[model samples]
Target: MRPKVFVSQPIPEPALDMLREVAEVTVFPRLDRNMSEDEWIMAAQRADYLFVMGGNIITTNVIKANPKLKGIAMVHRRLPVNNSIDLDTAKALGVPVVFQYPWEPVYDRIAEATCDLTIAMILDLAYRLIDADRYTRSGRTLQEHTMALMGPGVTGKIAGLLGLGKVALKMVPRLRALRMSVLYTKRTRLAPAQERELGVEWADQSDILRRSDFVCLEYDYNPSTHKMIGEREFALMKPTAYFINTARGRIVDEPALVRALQNRTIAGAGLDVFWHEPPGSPEMAPSEEFFKMDNVILAPHNGGATWDARTELTKATARQIVTLIGGGRPEGLVLD
Candidate 1:
């Protein structure tokens, strides 16, 4: 008998077809919205493998219901599997859960998006591009807008990366292309060859915070890194610096960020993630004070929502599932 696979939410057709080739695949009937926890458990109980997507909560009860489940795979980037899955229970049950890491082509798309947002935030905040466009649309001339809005240029500036991971590595060339100096800080320093190749100099966190014209957060969020940029870190930043976070929101203290902007401690910010998300959810407000700031540019955490990235992520998830079913160790296996 072929091994059974259950997909808790809809995925790309290509991945579904791939699973079908190796296993007996069962998917939740609805593609428009996610199934309830009870529904997910019901479907999961019958399978040997469970492939989950965002919005499905896989609790201990759900895990226990599926006695035959050998593995679980989360098919999205940045959505940590531990967030939804009961990792401790899975570990006790001897079931391995896997996630997608930002690597190679995966990092490429996300890095490109992050770089674009970083530049855009700097330019938008400094030049007041949105306001200028508004003035122009209201029948103002270039001279009036230029004179009123004296924006800063990006060339010959300093940029800081919080982590020297794949995304930061990919950003090196782009930052250099604009004639900017790059400083990075992480727990472990990169090899000398990597430093020379990427043309980045290692700096202490405080130094990067103090000297950079643009400070971008690209690190992973965990216990130690939670609220890593709080009042003290924000105080260390150049008052003229523009802050950008395409990473998780919990990494920065939201209250501190708001205060920084309000008191002009930092020039401006471009935020793609927030302390609370999916704007307008009961968890938080969609139009918070940040939305009121002309200096802040906000996106709905869509930095990596491109079609190509989504397709590739699904394909990667499919590969991992196949590997696990074959009794091979798949990449990105989350250990408890």
Candidate 2:
């Protein structure tokens, strides 16, 4: 008999087709924006496997309820200890938990794409050109202006990968090719040989902050990193610098950023994530003032939305589920 799996959230159509072929998959009928503890427990009881998102909670209690469960597969890139699947319980239960490396391609592509965008933004391409059609009507030319980037990640390559993890590994070569230098400050430094291999140098966190024209927050969030870039850090940045945060939202104090932009403490910023997902503010979209002013660019967390990236991610998730149901080790097991 095929194994029964419970999908706790909506997956794209292609993944659904693959899951149906290998397992009897049941997804919850209505999407709950956030699942309740009771719903999680009930879902665990019903399936041999669970494919979950990073935001979903899987507590010890939820794990204990699923006696028949074999593996919990996670599709999100970063899994914190407190939230999401409980690796300790899974280990005690002798269930192998898997994580799909969904962001690899997306990170590689974005590092390259972001470099391209950075060059364009530096050259003031968008500012210099008015819509050709609009030009005839207004008879006015917009003066081209340069954006002063706060971090040196894209241009100088003096980028510190807050965490020396997989995403940073892929981003290094791309940044180097664009004549950018790489710097990192972490709990443990990479050996001299490893740094040589990637052309990355180490910097004290403060030095990375003060010198970089663009600051990319590549570190994962922990208590130590939460609000790491607060008011004081912003104050240290050059008036011409722009900050870029594609990693997480809470890493920067959002309110501090607002004040910095308002007072021109830093030139501008580019943000892909927000402290609140789906920020329920009066501003409806990426083009609003909180983002579209003199020095900011906002993307709706679309760095990973390319067709190739999504297809690779979906296939990785499907393969993981298939391997688990076949009584074999999933290819990329993350949790012990």
Candidate 3:
């Protein structure tokens, strides 16, 4: 008899088929709703392994729900991230947890898809695409270029990236293609040789904020990043600049951002993440003000959400579960 596995969320068909070959797969039906803690524990009790994705609460209690649980598998951001998995407990129970490593054929493609969304957001704001769409739909036409929807164009502009990690690194070339100069900042600056190689310049956070025509956040959300961008930070931006955040929302103080947009402290904002995201679908975004602002372009926290990308990511994550259940160690960054 094949082992039983419970999947916390619906993954792409290829991944589900892959898992089905290894085990009897039980997938949660809803892609737009998260499982409660009780629901997670119940699922754990019935399965030999659990495959979970974003928003699933896999606490220590859930891990221990069934001592026979083989392992846990999921796709997440880079290694050593603050995620929902209970690593310590999983280790204590002798169940292994898996995460992807950058070099494992997942980073570049994932980075590309994500950077594509980031650039799309930047372009949308720079050209006022959404506003133009609404205007035309509202029976408004270009009468005489009376500044109805004029915006700062991207050519020869400056794009300042908050973090120069994988996604941002891939973004550098894309921004360059649009004839934009790139400035980047991180806790530990990159080597000068790497800077020259990547055709980027290292800049202080203040300088990036003060001089950039577009400010973008490209890292993860953690305690150190909690509310990193605030009222004072918004004041540092050029009023003609646009702000783009495909990173997590809590990194920026949403109210401060709202104030900035409300007062035109910055020319506009393109947001894929929100400070407060409800479970399941992004239908219940906490920031209502963004929905009303024409200067803002919003997305459902789905930067890495292309059909092919989702299938590949889910399939890659499922591969780890299959490897572990087959008595082979997962190739990913193994935690205990």
lDDT (CA) for every model shown? 0.78, 0.67, 0.83
| Worst 10 contiguous positions by lDDT, candidate 1 | 278-287
Candidate 3, residue 186: how far the Cα is off, in Å: 3.5
Q: Taking the tens digit of each residue's C-alpha lDDT, what string does model 2 give over 53-81?
A: 54567778888997778888877655444
**Model 2, backbone clash pairs (residues 3+ apart or across chains), number:** 20
Better of 1 and 2 by TM-score: 1
TM-scores for all candidates? 0.72, 0.63, 0.85
Name the top lDDT candidate: 3
Model 1 CA deviation exceeding 4 Å by range: 1-13, 16-49, 54-56, 64-71, 76-81, 91-120, 123-150, 188-197, 277-287, 322-336
Worst 10 contiguous positions by lDDT, candidate 3: 277-286
Predicted candidate 3 versus true structure: per-residue lDDT over 69-159, tens digit per residue: 8888767653455447778788788888777533446656667788999999888888888877877788754565758888888999999
lDDT of 1 by residue, 290-317 (tens): 9778778887675765666656777788
Candidate 3 RMSD computed on C-alpha atoms after optimal superposition onto the true structure:
3.3
Model with the higher lDDT, candidate 1 or 2: 1
Ranking by lDDT: 3, 1, 2
Arrange candidates by TM-score, descending. Answer: 3, 1, 2
